[model samples]
Target: MDLYIYNKALALQNVMDTYGSLRWVRRYTECGEFELHCPFTVDNIRLLAQDNIIRKKDSDEVGFIEYRNVKRDETDRENLIVKGKLGEGYLNRRIVWGREILNTTYELALRTLVDKNCINPTDTTRIINTLILGDIGNFTGNINFQVSYQNLLKVVEALCLEAELGNRIRFDKTLKKLKFEIFQGLDRTSSQTVNPQCIFSKEFDNILDQEYTDSIMDYRNVALVGGIGEDADRRLLTVGSGTGLERFEAFNDQKGISNMVDNVEMAEAEYSALLSSKGNETLAETKKVQTFENGVNLNSNLRYKVDFDLGDIVTCMSKKWGITIDSRINEIEEVYEESGKEVNIVFGKEMPRTIAQKIKLL
Candidate 1:
């Protein structure tokens, strides 16, 4: 597989068609990443430095190198290991300026956040001239959310996941800018007859290897939100209202969430709704995770991208295990090595892999 290299400025650089091994991963709810191992050569070393960009032809996932290391085996063989996160992670570099309460379609809310902080902030010093919002999202659903002093990427991702949506920041080669967009996957499950269904089942000989996990260890469906004030007088709200054995409650402290927007004090009910919105978003991070991972046979009737792609909801069943899953294609991994190319698919959200994700579990 050929890989194109570019500077962070989008300038064309070296291309590395030969590599020891490569792991390119794409995700729906989070930024994608890539790990590349290549022969230790002067050109490779110069091309794989931090801040450089790597991309695969015809793929929307573009990543910036963040790490590079040289490895030497006992036999004195040397190779370079390079790793990076996708351009979407650029949001991680920014933070919400202050308290933000959005009560509009999530599509516009997400764009407004990026626009205010990165593209065209009221503070001219914060403007990223080359970054622009794109017209890529059309999901229609009102969301009342509040966030303050938090990482921009994490907030946007949480909202997207709760809304059953996805997002990306694609490099506009000709325009020389990064376009941030929100998107939702198509429904391709067998339950729907309108579109061609993409099913992967052991019975069909397409699922090569499979592991299924259903866990509630980190799941909580109810949230008791605490707002400004003290004791019983404090503004309190609950989201994901459930009761009895069905209730899985957690507490969300949103004292920083102000009842005022743009210097005007909002009505009590309106402020309560905003508090509940923030609580709901916190609860969303504790959703029950039912993830499926497996090797896929590309030669099977189901073709990658053509039949189904990342973010598409597809059905998966294992008659042997007596479990069936209808979930979004949350992740796709492409591996390139000397032997050949291989693809693996991950359905549904997997366990939290980063410190930020793990903290939410606590």
Candidate 2:
């Protein structure tokens, strides 16, 4: 692994040989991010800034696709920490930085973020075309709103939630573009499965430890949303809807979805999505596994190698814990140090949407 810093013209600026540690993280619901800790030398400080580019190279392959310096810190003036996000740092850029979009298709809505050269002002051809765009329905009667100072990523999340179609948006580091994918479960045959013992050798264990958690917090019978409109001097309206969860219990939740829509129809649509999506599911379980190489090289062969990515479904078994999970990879965090790299995987089933996700209605 190697770290390279570059200038705006793509010129080699600085390289790190005695860095502290490097971390790369991937989340199912958001963009991946990276941080580099290195000595705060004069040469390194000169190459580090808010707009400078950083690249993590694994052999000849680009590990993070791309990263931009969004923040810098020199706590003791001896070691510096640079923090940033991946794929042009779209999350750090405000929605107001992009072009205005109104009542557009889901595809166009995403395109507007990158089409107007808002993501990267210097490079227009950096975004790749291997996007997994999903349908967001053909309803032209969608809500109307404007982009203020919110980040591009947050806006996209709200849009996906409002679409209410299991839609997801992520920055594909390897593909070098924004990916709009909808959850369609997993294709079992193509997925890699990990067990307490390796598939090739039961003598060599792959799982070090495991744990399980179950929750009913997502269960709800009613989803009530109330918000003020543009012409409101006070609370304008309240809308309540149910998903027929009387079988479970008389559970109810209230949300403030204010100043986000232009009319009642759009507001109702938002409420319906919330009720239908949040009420039907109640049982939630997550399985965390500590493994070697993240179960990648455990069963490798000439023709077969096991690997996993965000949202990929994999099977895990822990005889000690008495748990067998065929779950989706929800989060991944990796740490690289002088000793070696540690990759931690979190697997879960049935994740509930949060209030922050209702930004689409706003």
RMSD of 2: 9.6
Cα lDDT listed for each candidate: 0.80, 0.45
Pairs of residues at least 3 apart in sequence or in different chains that clash in candidate 1: none
State which candidate has the highest TM-score: 1
TM-score of 2: 0.56
Residue 248 displacement (Å), model 1: 1.4
lDDT of 2 by residue, 1-362 (tens): 57776553445677766787888765554455778877777777777766565666652111232333324454534677777765434444544453353545544555465444353434545433333343443433243433444566776555543443233444345544445444432333223433222121112244333334444554433332223333343332222343444423333232343323444345555545433332322211111222211233322331111344555555555555554445555556667888877665544434442311100000
Total clashing pairs in model 2: 1
Candidate 1: deviation at residue 308, Å?
1.4
Scored by lDDT, model 2 comes in at 0.45
* Steric clash pairs (candidate 2): 260-362
Give per-residue CA lDDT, model 1, range 307-362, as digits (tens): 99878988878888998878777777788889887776667753554311110000
TM-score of each: 0.91, 0.56
Best by lDDT: 1
